[model samples]
Target: MFDAGLSVEEPVRGVVLLRIDRPQALNALTTASAHGMIELYTRLALRTDMRALILTGAGESAFSTGADLKERAGMDAMAARAQHMAHRLAFSIRRGFDFPVIAALNGIAHAGGAELALSSDLVLAVPHAGFALPEIRRGIMPGMGGTQALTAALGPRRAMELLLTGDALDAETALACGLVNRIVAPEALVSEALALAERIAEAPPLAVSAVTRAVRGAGQGGAEAGLALELALHQRLMASDDRLEGARAFAEKRRPVWKGE
Candidate 1:
């Protein structure tokens, strides 16, 4: 259920590594690539054991520049909208994921690439990595949910500035602004991200999903709503079999075997 230009692998149990394989094109996302992503995520939904996902690019040059404009050069207005819709659909599926999603930026993340990283629950980039939203240069806008996601990642003022200026944000500045969680070595980027994912996979899936959902909701929902959601998810988890097992394991002083209930 995979496609060309995308590589899916399970280097460790319960963690999926998805690499954009079009390094020759800077991993730019064509409409077909977006459709491929939709198909890939749809197929991944059947894997109940998956606890984490790490998205990265194939090479050291770039994570992605996004929207293969070369391919879009011939597209008419209707065709462009269709392309936009495909990318939007792919991003929507990613946004709906309950498991933690990590973007391992090996190099530059520009345009929709930046949006992709923003969509993730965590972002780990290389020390030399750069992020930018340059859609304005093309007389377009960041339509791949970047406007909202960037605003949530950065404050509204910062996001507005970046969107308007179309400037690149260095990895250090991005880290200082809380856009990236860590700045890893280029060689260690994917491995470190995968290691983190492996660690996350050790925990109970139910708790992980609930935590991601509740915390990510804070961006859109006010504090009151966020608190309400957290409480609701917590209440739901209280009755789960995994919670009972956790208690039993604590009493027994043993590692809890989570059934993901």
Candidate 2:
């Protein structure tokens, strides 16, 4: 779990509870965490069980405060861009998963963190939680999808205000701006989010996944644009464990044990 700097929990069937486990630093993201998240998504995609995902922070203080500035203090421009791109890649792979992703924002979500929440299908936040895109203050634009997703969510004017000013919005203001679905108490956040996820999980998996693809694809470039990109990703996964398991199972005449790698 720490290998990915994330804590993955599946207490309920077909529901994944993924936490950014960096409370000491407000769950700030690092390069290793981003890469590990992408790796984890690859494994999860090979599985047939997942129906929903609840992404949140490990502690009560923050969903994430964006990238680890301390870690970035000495990074060159290329390294910094690479680190941000890793997080974006992780986000993209997660979108490929055929399920709903609910973001339970515990507290402040700034810069990259806001972009991460925008990546989810649904968002729930605590009353005191905040949202913002403060990259302008740092002189670099959002390396993730803040420019695109934020505009799509809040319209050009609202998104431009936050992007240009780096101002933060409280949970209520976020709700007013249609940035969050609802505000949950810190204690009730997980249980309620999990319950909501379980409710969605009760539906037919294939139909739900088809709907997910249709809706998620609508915001992106659409299925037609994804064909070539999908084939490229499929080719990249040709050497995965699940692929080898199929050949091995056939030769030995036994059921394949999917490694999901």
Candidate 3:
């Protein structure tokens, strides 16, 4: 559905795998690819069967090097502005996905690519993978949630240092900075990501969605507001059929078959 720039696969039931396929360009995102991603996420949002999504690059060299500079160089100011808007829309769709989204960073994720990884709920990167926001070096600044997301993930000071210096963070440093959940070997990256997705997909869908929403709310608001949101979501989930099924299954000593209610 994403043309040649992206590809989709159902590696397991209820789990969707999305790969950025422009390895020859270090999996860089052109305008077409960005719009394709937005369209794909929009369609996926309406699918009842989608439980989790894993995003990665097609090759080991890069998750993505960010925007296709060659394409950007040829664009006028108006065209650049339009492309920026498209990228923002795509990232927003990624961050708003109801189910869990995992970023499997197999290689270098620079500039917009790093921003994309930040949008994911969880990140699993390979040992050889590295991340950076080198837009500063190119006489530009990150425009795709880079600064804000970095500040939220790392503290303001740390984020500032990286953004100002345009230095690359290795996998270990990224993990320490809380940008990634875990680091796996290159060969194990996909397997580990899929295993994590499968585990999440096995949970009750309604409860999973509630947790995702509540946690995201907490990140965006104060403690008091977050607590209120959590309570409201908990109350709402209590009335769902999946909650009843879960309780019944526990009492019967069997697995609950969730209907995503």
TM-score against truth, every candidate: 0.97, 0.82, 0.96
Q: Looking at model 1, which ten-residue stretch has the lowest summed lDDT?
A: 1-10
Which tens-of-lDDT digit does each residue in 8-124 have in candidate 2? 989788798989999999999999999888888888888798889999997888899888888888899899889878888888889789898999998889888888898888899
Query: In terms of lDDT, which candidate is strongest?
Result: 3
Q: Judged by lDDT against the true structure, how good is candidate 2?
A: 0.83
**Residue 6 in model 1: lDDT:** 86
- Tens-place lDDT per residue, model 3, 27-69, is 9999999899888889888888888999999889999988999
Q: Which segments of model 1 are wrong by more than 4 Å?
A: 1-3
* RMSD, every candidate, angstroms: 1.2, 8.3, 1.2
Q: List the residue pairs that clash in candidate 3.
A: none
In angstroms, how far off is 62's CA in candidate 2? 1.0
lDDT of 1: 0.89
**Selected candidate, larger lDDT, 1 vs 3:** 3
